[model samples]
Target: MRVYSKTLKEFLDAWPGKKRFGIYRFLPLFFLLGASLEFSMINWHVGEVNFYRTYKRRQARKIAEEILASREST
Candidate 1:
């Protein structure tokens, strides 16, 4: 596998494209998106919950209550 990867890298390096803008340039973005998706799926699988949505709702409610309390005080 290491050999395969080395050869693959070499091929990409020699590929016909501007060295500054080759397919390899987008590899990091692809890796980042892939890793993010992988972790997101794992979180959803383990918790069966959308934490971001729930957290947003919780925060919104908290802010609303604070505003209402301040208004009552005024």
Candidate 2:
């Protein structure tokens, strides 16, 4: 399906003979590799206290203060 211009639906529509089942090598690479190596490349957690967590918390507190101030003004 990737190599040719024809989509799976189009190819199936042009199938010869009367058969309900058809073979497709849709994700040939994933099938042959037999592993989800793509997902294994990332480190899910970097330390319990990272810059990312600190930045997010700081930003959230700032936004909350802004919201409270706006409500008081209104």
Candidate 3:
């Protein structure tokens, strides 16, 4: 286990650009990626469909179905 951990650490330390700019440097890149994904999810659509809109409708339908099923069972 110790050997594997040491090997993994070495592999990560050898990642490109890690020497020039520590691991923290990748934080901004990931942040921008997340922001861009959020922006697209909010703004981009296919014809009139949207990611969040579909997700919300599906969740509402699921809850309604659960409620109906429970009532019928009782």
RMSD of every candidate to native, in Å, equals 6.4, 9.0, 6.6
Reference-based TM-score, model 2? 0.37
- Estimated TM-score per prediction? 0.39, 0.37, 0.69
RMSD of 2: 9.0
lDDT of 1 at 61: 100
Residues 21-71, candidate 1: write the lDDT tens digits: 755676776899999997785577435557666777899999999999999
TM-score for candidate 1: 0.39
After superposition, which runs of candidate 1 have C-alpha atoms over 4 Å from their true positions? 1-38, 41-49
Q: How do these models rank on lDDT, best leading? A: 3, 1, 2
Candidate 1, run of 10 with poorest lDDT: 41-50
Best by TM-score: 3
lDDT tens string, model 3, 32-63? 99999999998999999899999999999999
Score each candidate by Cα lDDT. 0.74, 0.61, 0.86
Overall local distance difference test of candidate 2: 0.61
Q: Model 3, which residues run further than 4 Å from truth?
A: 1-21
Q: After superposition, how far is residue 69 of candidate 2 from its true place, in Å?
A: 0.4
Per-residue lDDT of 33 in model 3? 99
